[model samples]
Structures are given as structure tokens and as C-alpha cells.
Target: MESMLFASIKPMLATVGDEPFDDEDFLFEPKWDGARMLLHKQGERIEAYTRSGRRVTDKFPELKEAALAIIAEQAVLDCEGVCMNGGRAVFDDFAYRLRLGDSRRIAAAARSHPASWIAFDVLATTREHLREPLHDRKRIVNECIEPSERLSPCAFLMGRGKALYDWTKEHRLEGIVAKRRYSGYQAGVVSADWIKVKHPVEIDAIILGYRMLPVFAFVIGLHFRTVRFKPVGLVEAGISAEQRAAFLGIVAGGLHAKQEGTTQWLKPALCCRIEYRDRSDWHELSGTTFKGFLPDKRVDDCMWTY
Candidate 1:
């Protein structure tokens, strides 16, 4: 493993689990609603990359002080890049920051809508090849990284997943993650050692198509096995007028569009994050609501669960 090139490595992923449990082997924490990022700090230079390996360091300059937050010669930290609004993480604010290109605009936006890095695990400085257990690695994070307004440590409870899950659910927070105490970090790997349970429901799905006639709603679906998309149902609520226009312009490029009756079919190119009450069936999504566009996710990332 190349120690310094950790920016190229993908962040480890969590698999969806059925229910939360109180187990001594697992440490549970609130699952953040934002993009996954891996922060690399070597000497005076710090770099931030999305789970897909896209460099987003310049996009949120307010976090530039993050380079000095880590009190170490070299380190690679797994963090969640989040924007807060009214005490809750807001994906729309974070997405808006990620889409900017101009430095002046980005700098100005950073002040108006700032993002923070919440460190959960330390990989490189804890050990080479991530051989250390999660408990020890997290200890390194708590000690090495000094907390600031922009960078802070993630909080967790030992053997109390069910309690945290209930609280998050009651408050309508994102959800909770259960990580094995002795598990080692696995870059780019989605393992059972780490489990994610959402509050009610929220998952990534592909925009199979859309219909504009009676009302504007997205025909959303998820990837099932080898199938590209398994159409679930239409997501009608929570999409702002600005969001509607923005998504329409991008999919209308003629590069990923097809017409089937009144519905405009689209190639499996656009992905969105949505929250629904539940899956009434294999094809129906109850109380489906659009969260926002997840640029960090691919079509394959929207895997079906049934």
C-alpha cells in the first residue's frame, strides 16, 4: 500500500442491515447525511477527495484550516463532509457547494454555506495497511486531531445501537451505523462489519425516466442484480422548482434520453437520493420524497434490496 497516495483509495462502505441491535462487539454512531470523503494531510498540504476519488478540496475553502487540525506528520482520515441547516445536515447545501467552478464564487459561498469534516476513523497514521483494529484507530483520531469549528471527531456509543437508532428515528435524523469494534478498514470494500440502518428509509436510485403531463414526477428505480434498473414508482414530492429545471436541462442533453409515450426515458446516467416511507411492494414506493442529487454515487451504487 502506498502510504502517501491514500487520496486515490476509495472510502470503505457500509451495507444495509435489517434492524439495529445492542451488541458489545459493535460501536454505533449516527449515520451522517452528506458525502463521504477521505482527507489526506501530509505536512502543510491537505487534500479532500470524494468516495469516487474526485478532489473537492478547493470547493470548500473554509475547511482549509483542516490541514492544521491534524497534529501529525502524515495521516489519512475517513470523514463525512456535511453542511448544516437548522441543526440538521442538509444535502442540498452541500451539493450546491460541490457544483461551483469559479474560485471567487466558491470562496463567497463557503462563508454563506460552510461545510465541516467529521472524522470517524484514522487509517494511515494509526498503522500501515490499516492493520489496527477500529477501536485503536478511533483512539488515534480522538487524540491526534484537534477539534475546531470546521473539523471535529465523530461521537459514538459502545454497545448501544438500538438506543441511538430509536433516538435518531424519533428526531427524524438520518440513521445510525454499527461498526465492529475489532474490524479493520478496507478501502473501497462494502463489508458486513459495518452496517447502515436508515431512519425509516432513504436510498440511492436511478432516474429511470419522467412524465411531465398531469404533474412533474420522477420515475425512480434501483439496480437489481445484473439488471440496470428495476422501476419502483414515481417520486412526486420534495423536489423544488429549481431542482426540476436543473435536472430536466441535464437529462435533455440528447445523450441519455428516449421517448416512450408521455414518459421520457433516460439512460442510467443520473442518480438521486430519496427517502420513502417504505416499499409497499417490489414496484411501489410509499410516500416517496426526493432528497437531492447524489453526484458521488453511480448507477451501480443504487443497488436494489428485495
Candidate 2:
């Protein structure tokens, strides 16, 4: 049979929320930390596309097998391509597999760190199901796909978002995504129909430098009374345009030291709040984002946790 090709549909995105709540109309699922992909399958032919429309079929042969295993004449699925390490999804492992261009290395990595497709939504089966309600489409996904080591339905809990979020946090999972039961899939839109609640580790850090190339980012450091200030990580997200302009002025005024390249060193006098998912093995903060400047927080008060 000739391979079938489907349009690359942009994956729907979720809006960020403060906390989780119990709602009869909502269903909660674990927000996996992995690449969002849409899988298209026809007979033995399979293809995968990322959120930005990048074709990644060659990178993950395991997921292709999983997609082909689905019992459908034609199907499209919304999923996360996850590589697990110690029972938790690891983005680094997934990225390692994604970046492999050579078939031999890709096969080797597949044997060592195989990826799985965690299906959460169904967009088509013989025909498009994009206009169907989420609850109905979810049923189609469960009915059409056979769960295996490389393919599994994303587990969900209804009307108990807070409890699910707490369980995710307790297990050190990334976060929880709550979606309206009756909401239809809106391609490329970051809709309020789905909201994400994260369990992030908060910290106070001192500003070490600033980078203004490509995008504005702050190089932050953890302060110790004995060791003074030590570099932790860089934060770029959550900084507003107004905040960026104001920070540029402040950095220019405090230019007492210099560093090579685009980084302009600043005196460890400014403090800010940062939130991150966790710390890497090198003690660097992972998924760091600026929360806000702490005008009342002194640099001496900045300390490292874990």
C-alpha cells in the first residue's frame, strides 16, 4: 500500500495556572517533560511531527513501531515522545535520541535509551476527529491503540485535579495538566481550556551578569556567607520587556567588572527570585525562570537550597 501523508497539525498548548482545583468538567493528567509530537499511521507506514512542524520520524524508530501497532486503517494521535530514566521522563535522554542523524548511532541509542509515545488525544481515525469533544476523542484513543512497552495511554483522573497534582509533586513529576472534558481541540492555540500547574523549586539568587544577544538573559549566582557568590544558572523567561530595559540600565550603571564575549559583569548587589524544576548533576538549576526582582531581599540573604 502507498504511504498516506497527513497535514502537519500544530499541537494544542496549555495555559499556565497557579494551582489545581476540583472541577467536575475537568480531567487531569501528568504533564510530561518531553517533546510534543503528532503521530500519523497508515498500515506499516508511520510519520511523526513536532509542535513546530519538524519531521522527526528518523530519530525515533521505536515510536514508529508503536504507531504502526495501533489497530486503525488510518489514525492521527497527539502524544509526548518520552525517554524514561529511573521512572521519570528525562528531556536530556530524549534530546540525545532526537539529535542523532546517523542511522547506526540512532539504533544504538534506541537500544540503550528507547523512547515511548504517551498518547493523550486522538485527532483522526479513518476521518478527522478534531471537532469532537475531548472526552469522546479520548475514548477513541483508548479504543484504537494497544498499550505496549513503547505505547501507552496517558493516565488521567477526573474531578480530582488537586489530588492528582499533589501526587505528581510527591513523585517528583514535572506538573499536572487539567483539560476541560467537553473542549474541542484548537490547533496552535494556547487555550484556557487546558491549564498547567507546576511544582517548581523557588530560590533567591544574586545577579552575576547579563547577556543581550539573541535574547536578554540574567546570569544568576547563589550566595554563601563563606564562599560569597557562586554562579548557578541563567534565566531568560518571565522577564517583561519593561523589566528588560530597566535591568539593562541597572547593569550599565554597575559595570565595575568585565567578562569575555557578550556578558557584562555586574556587582553581586542585585537579588531576584527564581523558580526551577530541579537541579542538574552539576548543581546548575534546570528550567530556570525569573520570577521577579526582590528589592527588599539583600544579596547577603541569597542562599542555595539543595
Candidate 3:
């Protein structure tokens, strides 16, 4: 059967919430640390993209099995591309996978470090379901995709976000996400209808610049107002000397870096995650520490918005 056209899509985003709360109108699920992906399948052809609309279909070729898992004529799935390590979802493993450029190496890594697409919502099947309530679309998700090792549905809990949040904390998972059961999907929008409560509230920041002199730190910033990179704070902890040397090597290998006084500024091309207590009003990350480099993420994806 020929595949019908689905509308251009972007993953819906979640607003940051202060804390987890139990409510009858919401459903909670794990806020996976894996890359946010949207898988589009048509007949035997499958394509995948990151949240910033970067095509990554070839990067994770194992995910092409979504075409087999999806029983619908055509489908659009909002999912997370997770890399597994020792039976646990490891973001670093997936980041390493994204760093590979050779197709043969990527294929080899697929077997060595297997990954899966964890579907959370279905936006289309035989027809578009953007207007359908989230709870209603859960049934459609079940109908559209058969759960398999390559692709599986994300299980959710109703009216117990705090419990799931506790579980994630105890297990050292990212956090828990709560979505309004009656809310419809809004592409590319960050709405309060879907809320994310993180364990320590991590933020993705652009590597605006770096200073290697007295402190050996990374100058992290966000693209708020978005005219230019807004300096937030320095990421001095959690990044080892080995990581620092590797990052500087990339800069030396013509990734574009220029000296600005004592700091070396680069073009907007690199990003890193930061674990912080809160975002200050003056655009600073309070009690900040380096989390990890984001290889699958776009530079502009590190925005200051909620």
C-alpha cells in the first residue's frame, strides 16, 4: 500500500513544573534522558527526526524496524530514541552512538550498543489525531504499533506523579513527566498542558565560549531573546581533564574558535547539559555543574524558555 502524506511535524514540548503533583486529570510517565524523536512510517519506509527537526533516520538504523512494528498505512509517532547499556537506559551510550559518522561503524554499534524507539504518543495513523485528546490517542497508539524489542509503547501512570517521581529518583532516572489527559497535541509548542518535574532540574546550555586559564571552565549560555548567545554561568565541575582535552581538540581541529580577551569564543555549534538548582533572574544557573555533552542536539535547542 502506498503511504499518504502526513503534515510537517515537530515534537510537542513540556513546561517545567516546580514539583510533582497528583491529579486525576493527568497521566505521568518517565522523562527519559534519551533523545526526543519523531518516527514517521509509510509502508516499509521509515524516517526519524530529532526534536529540532534534524533527520536522524540513518544514525539509528535499528529504529527502521518501526515500519514493521507499525501496522497502520502511515503513522507519526512521538518517541524517545534510547540506547541501552547493561539493561538500563544510558544517555551517554546514545550520545556516543550519535557521534559516529561512518555508516558501517554505526551499524556495528547497533549490535554492540542496541537502541530502541520508545513511543509515547501517536500523532497520526490512517488520519491525523492532533485534535484528539491524549487519553483517546493512547488507544490509537496501541492499535497503530505492535510492541516489540525494537519499538515499544511507553507505559504511563494515572493520578500518581509523585510516586513515579520517587521511583525515578530512587533508581537515578532522569525524572517524571505529567501530561493532561484531555489535552490535544500541539506541534513545536511548549505548553503547560504537559509538565516536566525533574529530580534536580537540568537545563541544556550552549557552549557559548570557554576559558582555560585560571579555572579551566566552560562558559555556558542559552539562546533567549535569541539575537546572540546569552551568557548564563560557568560549568566547572563534573567535566574531567580527559573530556576537557577532547573538547579543546575539537576546537583546534577547525571547529572555529577565536580568542576574546582571556576567553575563547566559538560559533553556536556545541551544546552541553547542566544540572542546577534553579535559573536565576539575571540569567545565571545557580549551583551549576556539568552534566554531559549533547551530541544529538542542535545548538539552538538549548533555549532559555520553560
Clashes of each: 0, 0, 0
lDDT of each: 0.82, 0.84, 0.82
Measured on C-alpha atoms, candidate 3 has an lDDT of 0.82
Clashes by residue pair, model 1: none
* lDDT of each residue in 149-256, candidate 1, tens digit only: 788899999999999999887766678999999999888899999998776677889888999978899999886655668898898899999999999898868736
The better-scoring model by lDDT among 2 and 3 is: 2
- Which stretches in model 2 have alpha-carbon errors above 4 Å? 1-5, 202-207, 210-218, 221-255, 259-273, 277-306
- For candidate 2, what is the TM-score? 0.74
Report each candidate's C-alpha RMSD, comma-separated, in the order given. Answer: 11.6, 7.4, 11.0
Candidate 3 residue-wise lDDT, 1-306, digit = tens: 123243346789998886899999999998776788888887787888777777777888786665788888788899998886655577756766777889999989999888898899988787778899999998888888888889988989999999999998887677889999999999889999999887776788889788977888888888765345888888888899888998999877776667888798887788989888444335577667898899888986788643
| Model 3 vs. true fold: TM | 0.68
Output the lDDT of residue 100, model 3.
86
Which has the better lDDT: candidate 1, or candidate 2?
Answer: 2
> Which candidate order results from sorting by TM-score in descending order?
2, 1, 3
Deviation (Å) of 30 in candidate 3: 0.7
Candidate 3 ranges with C-alpha deviation above 4 Å: 1-8, 201-306
